[model samples]
Target chain A: MTFLNRFAGLRLYAVLFVIFIYGPVLLLPLFSLDTGLYPTFPLKGLTLQHYAEMAANTSMIEALKNSLTVAVIVSALSTTVSIPAALALSRYRLPGAAAVLGFMSLPLLIPSIVIAVALLIILLKFLGVALSLWTVGAGHVLICIPFCMSVLMSRLEGFDPSLEEASRDLGCTGWQTFWRLTLPLAMPGVISSLLMGFVVSFDEFVIAFFLSGTQTTLPIFLFSQLRFPDKLPGVLALGSLILAGSAVLVVLAELLRRRGAKSANPGDI
Target chain B: MAGYGLLSPALLIMVAMLALPIAALVLLSFWRQSGYTLDTTLTGANYARIFGLSDSPTVWMGIPFYLAYPVPVILLIKSLMMSLTATVTVIPLAYPMAYFIAFRVRSGKSIWILLLTIPFWTSYLLRVFAWKIMLGYTGAINSGLMALGIIHHPLDALLYNSGAVTVVLAHSWVSFAVLPIYVSLEKIDRSLLEAASDLGDTRWQRFRRITLPLSMPGVIAAALMVFIPTVGDYVTPTLIGGSGGSMVGNLIQDLFMKRNNAPMGAAVAIVMMAVIALIALLFVWLTGYHKMRARRR
Candidate 1:
């Protein structure tokens, strides 16, 4: 192909590809708005009936509550644990730092299915812990820690050590220095980590599916509802809401992460 | 000691939640299950069943010979094929997009990256369901075609198949491919391209020699990232992939949930992990990832 033809082709491909990624997502709100039960087209006169139905559904509400609970717990637990570890790895000359960092990130590399199965057996067989929201929370913690660590680590690495040194020279204790100076400076990463952890935990499915017994999380509930053709509209409405919520959180997290990175190396910006 | 103390909490959690369970998975695979009770005695039965090397009398009879070559193995192979196909397909699609953002987008590259990742952060279930809706018989594509008088009836071939699964997967996974490749592509010094053009090298030749090699690391990383997760993905296949499109992950899920055979599921899970690990090692070795890192250092 000629260079001009190829350039045009690439642009066309990119546009088509974006459509591929987003077209169906756009359909979600359209179908959710459609008055018909089915997602079929022909402009069935837009109505918010499905969303109203979703609002009235008790089980959907329950599942959303459970999901929110799990996400909050997971985010708090994972971020709290990740911060000190991130601080240690970034601020100290720890032995086996490479291996420790690798260990922290191991969960991200492994498949969710494998982790779910492993956790399932351990909880059910060994610990004798009944499958519940807490099990799901623990699993979320396992997965979210690495992400929290990464975000916090980047933020910590960008921090100016001399600031802490100056605090020490000014007769401040280590705890005071951390609380007064370091923690405030690292606040962006901390917030970003919490948001990232929450989003990850909220969107997670397989682990919750495996670990949850009677109390279904939002995703597990959503997956089960897909089997019922009548539930399609409600699920579509739910999906649209989730899409909007996650989009906002992701954008916010990205902005915070970028802000943290910019502060880390102010010269880059 | 202070550093060690700070690291201990995360390490203990990982060991308890991650390392110990993986160890238990291996041990569980060795334990025998008889009816409702799981006997604590170690046995090679689960492994044999997974590999189709079981020593049951039915093996001698060759009746139900299909059992000799177990479903998990076939499913694993199918998953391998699906992941490989999806990864290969996604590369070409992602490369051009990444190229556009890195080279063509003169300003607001961060905004483009953020936009791409916004969809990435959306629920995986919703994304898969979106594709399912789009490719359904009476779904968007079919309805649009009908509205245009392109066809009378909705196309049944669009959804509930392996092709649908692959297409949706490639679509959902495009961002993962884009981010890494974009990073690598962005790192390409513009001066090199300008110099090559000044030396009368054609655009294609310049891309072939300089751009391609420079971006290979990111491409490889992206491929690994996509391929590994896709291998164990049950969600996409479940939503779009019908019975024929089921992968090892679906089979493993069934073994645990429906079949109530945790040991066998553990075996299958381990086997899948082994396959992923092997593929990852091969990719790392072929790409000389260590060499690349050392050179950078």
Candidate 2:
């Protein structure tokens, strides 16, 4: 009780910090609702004209499709590849475990622009691969795997080995034990990883910018459209929808993370 | 062996997708560039161009002078300074918020964290654009000021400068700072603070001696999380940054696309990575990260 009063000033700062963080973004939805062509102040009137225009834009719909496809493939690939690696890192006292972990996390430390440029060069020169959604997915997987591994490692690390032993004693084979026990235990972690990975791939711009071929991601399309003043309202409308969708996804992911934290061991994500 | 087998596919992907490409980037940095094709011959010309150093030695009275730096080198240094400024600005703001959530909220901590992260979940491009809209001459800030009769003319200095880049980047990366700091604050043993208070230490003294030292790891992590990524940020500078606010990343993109110089771009990328790694190492050393890791072990 005394502690709360001692630092009562902090609550004000926290509120201000929240305002500072979200003020610009929250204004986005307000402007989207304004009938004004520009997202400036003194809105003309409330209307859904921008949203209607956004709905009618073929390029916007196509970009959405491309983004979804890239995001789904990247999420699946990242989680699938990370599961075994996370298992090995958590369960075994492997040689060079620290080095392996460090290497896996290198992408997070380096600039995304560098990663994008490096991947672009590698695909173009060494592999003779063309710039496509597949290439973007490849880069996304490279970056997203580390995130997936971090979440899965926490879930896997806390598993009771004795549970597997008990299952085996009950005549369960390796595959059956994994299916019945291990998967269910780690399901929350897996879900969070998938959702977070999807979000990362969906919103990522740099790699998609470089690796995008004829079909571009939503970010790339939005970026190109930013230069045109006339496109501002419609883009804001699209951005508002995306903002709402992302908020839901992030909330779901956080809820899953909390559930995993309660049921499994508490891990600082 | 089975563990090794389990790790192989991941290792393969990392090597193939990440390590090998970086290696190729370094190699390409050295390779000579001709009209439109890169020569197989290895040369140090790209490095020389990136650093504004000349190979020819013309020592006048034992004093050495180099050629003028290319534009990208200047932008790289500017980017480093701007990113540092933004990281420094965000630390003070984020620390208080993280402290509040960790110690004050008590319950519904996750909800606070979720609210903080809501901005990040949305498109980073749009968030930066949002700042652009707010800062533009005819945008929110100017109009609000005019409507309130605070100022007659629109403020021209509100956007398209290094300062605007710093402000937007700091805001965009605040969640990164808050999360790490919150985690570290949570890890601190509450009884330690109580014990400090019980020893007749004032609140400031207890925070300085106990809480601050304990949270150094998170502070350093937060700093790195914000600093490293913002240094090479292309979007913020591109939209709100105008000519004066362009970064190393914007230059690198131009080097590849507009100038048709992949070798130079690769060299710039390599230099940027090396500079970031050096800064990170310095930060880790100053924060006693090695000692912290040892103590944990």
A34-69: candidate 1 lDDT, tens digit per residue: 998888868779899899999999999999999999
Clashing pairs in 1: none
**Positional deviation of A229 in candidate 2, in angstroms?**
0.5
Number of the predicted model whose DockQ against the real structure is largest: 2
Binned by DockQ into CAPRI classes (incorrect, acceptable, medium, high), candidate 1 is medium
User: Distance (Å) between predicted and true CA of A241, model 1?
Assistant: 0.7
Residue A161, candidate 2: C-alpha displacement in angstroms: 3.4
- Residue B111 shift from truth in candidate 2, angstroms: 1.4
User: What are the per-residue Cα lDDT tens digits for candidate 1 across B187-259?
Assistant: 8888999998999989889999889988888898889888989989988989899886778889889988899
Model 1 RMSD in Å is: 3.3
TM-scores for candidates 1 onward, in order: 0.94, 0.94
Global lDDT for candidate 2? 0.87
